[model samples]
Target: MQSYWNFPAAAGGTINSINNAGIETFKGNELDSLTREICQNSLDAIKDESKPVVVEFKSFKLQRNQFPQRAELLEAFNKCETTWKGKNPKSEQFIDQAKYILNEQEIPFLRISDFNTKGLEGAQTGELGSPWSSLVREAGSSNKGDSSGGSFGIGKSAPFANSKLRILFYSSQDLSDYQSHIGVANIMSFEKQPGQITLGTGYFTNNENSNAIPGLINLDPGFNREETGTDIFVSAFEPKDMNWVEAIRNSVIYNFFITIWQNKLVVKVDDEVISHENIGSFIAQLDDTNEDYRHVKNYFRLLTSEDSIQIPYPAKSYKKIGKFEEGEATLFIMKGEDLNRRVLMTRKAGMRLFEQNRISGSISFTGILIITGKHMNQVFKKMENPAHTLWEPSRFEEAPKEADTAFKDLRRFVRETVQQTFQAETTDTMDAFGLSDFLPDTTTVDGEGDDKKESLTLKIKSIAQKKKEKPKKKLKKKQRNEEFEDTLADAGIIPEGDQAGHSDEEREEGLGLGGGTGNTHGEQGPSDEGTGGAQEGKGEKEKNKPIDVEKRYVCLQKNEGLYRVNIKPEKKFEKGKLEFKVSGEQSDYILPILDVQSPDIQVISIDKNVVRFINLTGKKLKNIKVKVDYEQYCVMEVDLYEI
Candidate 1:
């Protein structure tokens, strides 16, 4: 029975030492990597699409005497200890620990079994790209298709990394009715004889064909995988390390929650079943205080919340990325507080790759982008790093230009969506440690148009405080004309021949959304304020000339009525203030005079608007930022005061 174990002696110059660089890729993320890889592989081999794939993570103990090839393994360990006495201290220390573990009366092991899958196919043939070979014998080999969750084969190392003994057993009952078992040890080279060195990698098999045993061997008396699918066993699983269980549970919930939510996968950690039926319960029980845990909680919330906006990724992106076939995918965004401001990108299979971080805007939002078509999945899968965390441009060595534009297009699409949908720059102060991101008596109001939803930057106001606004004192025609002339003079806009196309009726009511400078025909800047300033002194001819303001951005924060405006000036100005106004189907009007705050721009006087802010800062008045406060409303518009 023990004759099948094989560890051949290497030639004189060749020596097999322990090289765990593959496993080391998952060093700090052992359990997560393991959980993610196992479920992904299982999902890839779904035999029945109607049934959910079930996986069990359980622990069992076996006596040392029942361990197969105990004597042969002990001899190898003893030889390794003697041969590498002082050469490799780490290896020497590891071998000492492994030897001690082997001598214990009962050893603990973890068996991960998956059911309702085709299992490892082509087990009868040890081909280079066979599932069994790719998983057990070969390194960095995969025959999975585009729809599959992963292609880079380094994921198999995760399970081995989890083993303190650096040993694992692979047993599978393939759908073809073939059952086989194999034991692989990743250890250091050992001196088999006085002058002979055996290879570091050893196999436990019986015959000349050392790939696999005929049938599954009994690992534990009560624990066995009688169903179809694969079972991976890790020796010296560190049963005393309860942290491992927690790590496994967290990983399952974080990475596979979508899979479970879709009824495509189910995970069991020592009888604690995490399935589609209980995903909400599991998420509700999680303490979102843990930043790491909060991500999945929020993601799950976005998945189920009807408030989430489903925006499809552009079909043009497929063509821009040099792909012929179009793929369908959606980015679901939930705009609110308690968000990480990142987008989670997942394969169509429902297993997430990673949260795409540093999304361009400061919107109080988090999202999930599900890549759901075969061709598109293939495109992104190729661009993914070995870890599948980000979409890197360097991956497209053939066409670097397309790679360059792909990211720009993605970001532009997201920006355009936000502008078209939210119609405002959104941001919020994340809860300062211990403080809740929630408020009592939250309120929401209807947006401007049929399509517009609640504004992300809109502040909450109670019904009691939301009484009708006090009407603005109607200004006389002369006063309105004079005010209009002053605003035009400051904006450097001398309207066409006196009043362009305005009548006494229009002039008497208010500015009446006057057309001039850059802000005519309703072009809101999406951020800072509506266009037209001292900068636009001339028409298209002045396009190349410098302006008083180069660029600016406006952000509406959580604080009631607070707005932060960032301004970059093209030229120096001793002072400038941003005036506020409102215009719509109704005649244009001014906001009720309120408080103003700024580091650079001070309240010289608040008639309608006055900042002529800060000496305009920066020696040359290069750029200045200001935060102002007033009654909050989405219709508010701004204008840079007298230059």
Candidate 2:
């Protein structure tokens, strides 16, 4: 066998380097191109339909290297080199030629022609041979014409900015030819000479060409039937440190799905279908209203080359109406040259102004702006001061008197409208929440008994008490069960029965009475009964009443009744006379019975059950009738006057 190691050195080494770099390197420029191609494809897909299209991002995974080494790599390289040499064109020369073709084509009208030497209008451009171009052709083509977003054909150079290896695959329909075709392009940067680059192209095959261009390749080789669509793959390349997904999302705004597709395209990245309807929906959601339709009335005119043409640009508007609660309107503009494009612009009229000194303009209107992709560098030229005065080309040009007056009127209208809607002069909190009328006019209370003036102290106190008392009942019940059961059960009983039989005769033997034994009546018993019974009965009667007899009481007769007294003779009277007083008053007073013959008061001895009254001697005295006031003894009284 021929030694595979002896194969062409240049080709094998190049292929090997690319294989080693892996998917990220291959993904490089190819990913960007794929994004652009898919966006373009979506636009083409929606050209003939009015229904909203749904584009989905499907699966994407990197595959390993599989290309052969040495001889096989040499053969592939030779084939590409031979084909490229056959064209006999430099890279810049090819770009110029492509531009010339686009400018000469008459398929669509060019909106602005400032690049033309005489600033002429309404010139025809020829048809662009292929909608897509490699970096070599883009750099070499002399004629800069409008077919897509790129002007100097530099848009194709964007993929090489941060990538080492790249691959791109796309499928499109040729409406004129009534067929579909699949195309693939791949590129790689050489390790030996980092500046050197290589590219390749090929097509797929299918039995039926009805759904594709006659000589075009079929995108899905396994599918027997032909379908009109495209797919792209970009691998092994590294993207810039910036967020690529956000960059792509922003690009979708300015370059609508239709224009990117070249009017006969349908593309997918990994597998996301890119369509105008889907892009429009995205823009609609972004603006949050139909107000964007008003801004869209203006046209984006891209002019290239000295002989470029300008045509009357028609404007289309779409509107959405709702309350003012929706967010402010935003407009996105993509402008500038490759590698230096500005991607975001907040001003309505100056969004896409570039800052790199290469391009200048304003993308201003009445909305928010996001400018991105390869064109940012050509639009805004300086980042130091990127305002309207610095970046907008219009600022440097003279304006007609009428135009100036019209612009002034428009500015006034915008200012007034913004004021009415946003109330910009007022504080943000006050305007946003409409709280101007909510503040209290006065802090002081107006009335003495206003309900709102009730104190919260009492309510708080009651709530605190209830919280403290709730746990006590549970504790008491638990203690009763554990410690107090027996005391409660035996509290109230009397003993009797067997004690009565033994007590009669034996109880008499212990008695101190002089009576003998049982039932017979005798003189000794009678004498004993009379004396002992009397003394015993007296003692028993004394025992029946309260004991600790400390005094003997006597009833003294007075004019109206009799009063009882307990006094010791030896206890000296403070005033040399007897005095009686009640609890409430300070004066001492004595009461006299009115009829001495029958006293109303009664007195009894310590153990006597009977009482006796004494007759009083009438004596004339100045204060004999002592007033015993009952007022001092009043405890509780009830009013019975109504009855």
Q: Which candidate leads the pack in lDDT?
A: 1
Considering every candidate listed, which one attains the maximal TM-score?
A: 1
Per-candidate Cα RMSD to the true structure, in Å, reads 15.5, 44.0
Q: Over 4 Å off in model 1, which ranges? A: 1-3, 12-16, 239-241, 317-321, 324-327, 336-340, 357-363, 424-643
- What lDDT is obtained when candidate 1 is compared to the true structure? 0.66
Write one digit per residue (lDDT tens) for candidate 2, span 63-137. Answer: 222211223333444443444453534422433432332233221110100010111011111123333332222
lDDT for residue 97 in candidate 1, whole number 0-100: 90
Question: Model 1: per-residue lDDT, tens digit, 41-111?
Answer: 89988889999999888888879987777877888888888888989888888888989988999888889
Worst 10 residues of 2 by lDDT: 634-643
Q: Which stretches of candidate 2 lie over 4 Å from their true place?
A: 1-46, 52-73, 76-152, 156-170, 180-229, 233-421, 424-643
TM-scores for candidates 1 onward, in order = 0.67, 0.29
115 Cα displacement, candidate 1 (Å): 1.0
